[model samples]
Target: MGGSPAHLDSPMVDGYGKLQTNGLRFHKRLTKNPCLLDCAQTKEYMLHVFRDCWRARTIWERLVDQDKWVGFSQGSSENWFLRNLEADFNSQGVTRWRLLFGVTVWQLLRRRIDRCFNTEVFGRDPVGVILDYVLEVELAFLNNKNLGRDST
Candidate 1:
């Protein structure tokens, strides 16, 4: 995860896909269902969590334009992460698509883990939560710009 942007999304030692497979593993949480939403009886694997999950799709919908949704959502999962990370825009013309994408993935996984541990907050909105995290990180990065931080 240190040298590659794609490595930042391996779902290893992280509450991303395999770890949040409806509690089938990762210490086996409260439920062993197919999905945290409990609406799909399918295994919550990496691709599912990244692109197919209903909740994840919702987050993508809010971020991606309808015209580009198909391209952004479909295809081999291997190219999915890399293409998105290399993208220069995030539908809204935001040049920081990579940052937004990374933060959103992290927040999605974080929310999944949180739901597994805290059922009381199951109604949480992932899109809003993820964007908030993205905004915070973006702001911090912007603040550090021209401040000798990127000189490394």
Candidate 2:
């Protein structure tokens, strides 16, 4: 059941795989580490890349703890977002804020991969990028909602 296209093509799964592959390849080439070049994929590595990576941890902590936008369970990105959407909807944040959170998290993951893989320097701060993305998305959502209100 979890192997369906809905699961396979999820942004979280795709993003995680892409980031993990890019990160592994970049580190191997940069450091000339043969061990990394042959490293097998694992769930632990994917979790580390998505959640515990030094760059990404701060954003996860802030969103889950400070903002209360997410829960505490460690799971795939798709599961996490789906669970959070339900919780947020039940909590009455469903209209716009929930969508903003979901989209921002997805964007943050992609941005992290882009910054890491596309830059001349290898190390990029995922947490900082996540924060910036969250703010940008939130502002856009608010602006759009306000425009709708004014038009109505």
Candidate 3:
């Protein structure tokens, strides 16, 4: 019950202004450009990078239900996270919806880093690949929990 906020901030655009150090004076020296996607120049906000960007959109479309996607993608980052953390029993029909949510966003950020800073490496469809990995981990965690409970 302690994960009130996750470090899902995007230092590139949204978090740039939140910095208070004297560094803020020369913050312009930092890279102030497109989002992690690099090509997505319109909005460099954290919301766009993690949820609304085309790259994130494709993955969320596959991972989230069409009925909830609209609301899920809307809201201040803090509210979006608070709701996800306090949400009911299951999201993707799994007991740990918040875990699934966290992992998906983490993977999205990792992917963004990979695509921008490192070499992109995924099979035919990268989105599908990431989705599969996230779901697989969710199931693995459930299985591990079941195994622990069974032995107890």
Candidate 4:
């Protein structure tokens, strides 16, 4: 939404399988539940982590609150993930949503790692930390684009 869509080559972007399953296994080995965030009620799978986890759900709801076109909880969680991936490229918010979606997944995955391997580094507020990181990266991206244009 902010810049011409550029290809993201990292596994974090193109490797849905890796992101989803790795977190599942990593957290599973740690807590016997695949969920990155422990809600203490039920075992978490990929969909729950991204869509139903109270923390993640709140983040997504806030992200799309003003947009009428999309709501994260409107339909099947699996369908939601698949549809967003294949959404019409020309749609107004699809690009932006895709970017945000990827960032959220990446951050969630990172949080999972920290929770398991570096407990001291995992913050008390994971959604907040993730949002801060995403915003910081977005700002850097915008600044780099501006510098490129100025140089050209």
lDDT of 3 at 42: 47
Clashes of 1: 0
Q: List the residue pairs that clash in candidate 1.
A: none
lDDT of 1 at 125: 78
Weakest 10 consecutive residues of candidate 1 by summed lDDT: 11-20
- Runs of candidate 3 with Cα error greater than 4 angstroms are 1-43, 88-92, 146-152
lDDT string for model 1 (1-152, tens) is 35545534544434443343664643454455544464454456776777788878888888887787777887777888889887643665545888778877877777666666666575657676667777788787788885767686
Clashes of each: 0, 0, 0, 0
Candidate 2 Cα outliers beyond 4 Å, as residue runs: 1-46, 66-71, 88-100, 120-132
User: What lDDT does model 4 reach?
Assistant: 0.57
Which residue window of length 10 is worst by lDDT in model 4? 8-17
Give the lDDT ranking, best first.
1, 3, 4, 2
- Model 4 TM-score is 0.54
Q: Write the per-residue lDDT of candidate 3 for residues 1-152, one digit (tens) a residue.
A: 75323442444223433322113323554434333344436435566667777877777776677777777777897787788787642335645667667777777666665564457575567555655776788788789999999998
C-alpha lDDT of residue 94 in model 4: 31
lDDT of 4 by residue, 1-152 (tens): 56423433432333333343444455445345554445764455667666777766666655554444354455676787777665532222333556666777767656655555555664366556655666777788899999999998
- Winner of 1 and 2 under TM-score: 1
